[model samples]
Target: MSALHFDEATHTYTENGVRVPSVTQILAPLNDLSFIKPDVLQFKRDLGTAVHKATELYDLGELDESTVSPLVQPYLDGWIRLRAELPFEILGMEERVFHPAHRYAGTYDRLVLLDGKRCIFDLKTGAMFPSYGPQTAAYKNAVEKASGKRVEGRYAIELRDDCTYRLHEMTDPEDWQVFLGCLALHRFKNKHAA
Candidate 1:
């Protein structure tokens, strides 16, 4: 595993050789006027792409195996198999939101009742870590707030050849708030930076 660290406690992030920016530094006024950013739009686009790809795979079956994503093939295959064997339906994927309280709209990967329980499964194609908890929670909060429905839990389908998954049951609201706050703070900084 890689030890890439983004000091959220300090509000710093380091990617490759670029110096990380602090939340305060980022939130600092760039000019007299404030503006919504293009990056946010791009982020929504990227999320849309991811959600679209997952849905395509789910609807059309697995893509032709490629040499690059071989390690994650089983994970996708397993999800395909699970999706096929059961009466599981893709309730909605990449549904957009226009909530006023939300910093930005969110896209949900899957909203389906599994074995009689409503669940949210996020497709993870990258590395694993505990840091993603808040982001997921924020998504849950956003979805629930937008849809006026309660989300019981959050999960990640780790797509690999081994086809393993990690299930995270949503805890109380406090921890969920922490993650949401972090995202909110980041958005504040991002807006200022723009």
Candidate 2:
């Protein structure tokens, strides 16, 4: 097994003691969230993060529902609703994976058997933006590379604030290429950092 470490504080990954950029980091150059005010952006980031943690804990059977904060309850409910509808068997949750060839790493939300199909997933607590496709594509690619098992599907489950979710099938063939392009640009920019 390769030594892959994810530092939660910095949202970074290190493989074999060498720093490796994450999917989001590589795609940051093209992610224009600038329209959101800084404070609103921070709040959204925090809420999304909290929801992810709560959902992971719940999936692992470690969450105390009673302790769930009211602020994140709706998002959790959205996830639960999705579970009720899809009825998936969880194979992996909050899994950290790295692509040896691309040298990028990311933590995917879940890998599941949905209707007997192997599907990799990403959970979102906000709008299902166009970027989600590439984000999930990068995750699917990394997970497939780290594990020999083939991932037959890629999805983004957007959990809204009102206890509802929309499932998006990321079937676009160009999404992975988009992420790879971002990675290349990131590398070039890093190499020429002033």
Candidate 3:
């Protein structure tokens, strides 16, 4: 257990020997609609904590009721069971390096291999939104680049609200190109800052 260290000056996360740029750090210059709502921030923290705890328990082979909120417990349990019983590997648990123009670093939620097919997943502790499609597409691009192979599908595990999971195949290469363009721009900007 560690405290969340915040840089009052930069508002970034600095803990566990990792520097996590605040949401504002990545979104501030991109657009005006980058404000982090209170609810969204809370959900993000909770989701990350839940995943971390689940991972620890998995390593120890411990199976018990999840510590996450009841509404999201089902999804957590399902993931644990699936991981234990199914033949799949979660690859994105390892931190990946990203060199972008404006953004030099970022991490994906989860990249997995299931049934000999690559899968990219972004777990959400909230309701599904229309924008999730593009977000998942971005994850697909990130996973593909990091793994040097194409992903068969992108998915979002909505743990709360509707508690639904959605999967979509990446049929359009153009979408991936757009995502890469964004990463390039982010990397460029970061280099200029450096």
Q: What TM-score does each of the candidates earn?
A: 0.57, 0.96, 0.55
Write candidate 3's Cα lDDT for 73-118 as tens digits.
6656556654566567776652443422222333446678878887
Residue 175's lDDT in candidate 3: 52
TM-score of candidate 3 on Cα atoms, chains taken together: 0.55
| Global Cα lDDT for candidate 2 | 0.89
* lDDT, candidate 2, 1-194, per-residue tens: 68999998988799999999998898887778999999999999999999999999988889999998898999999999998888989999988899999999988899999988889889988766777888888988888787887888999998988999989899999999999999999999989999
Backbone clashes for every candidate come to 3, 0, 13
lDDT of 1 by residue, 1-194 (tens): 11223543643444343334432232233212224377865654454345347545656556555532443455556666656665665555644332334433344577777766666776664454454455456567667876788877777655444554445555555646665566567666667995
- Candidate 1: give the clashing pairs: 72-160, 74-161, 75-160
Off by over 4 Å in 1: 1-55, 60-72, 84-87, 168-173, 191-194
Sort every candidate by lDDT, greatest first. Answer: 2, 3, 1
Q: By summed lDDT, which 10 consecutive residues of candidate 1 come out lowest? A: 24-33
Candidate with better TM-score, 1 vs 2: 2
Ranking by TM-score: 2, 1, 3
RMSD per prediction, one decimal? 12.8, 1.1, 6.7
How does model 1 score by TM-score? 0.57
Alpha-carbon error at 185 in model 2, in Å?
A: 0.3
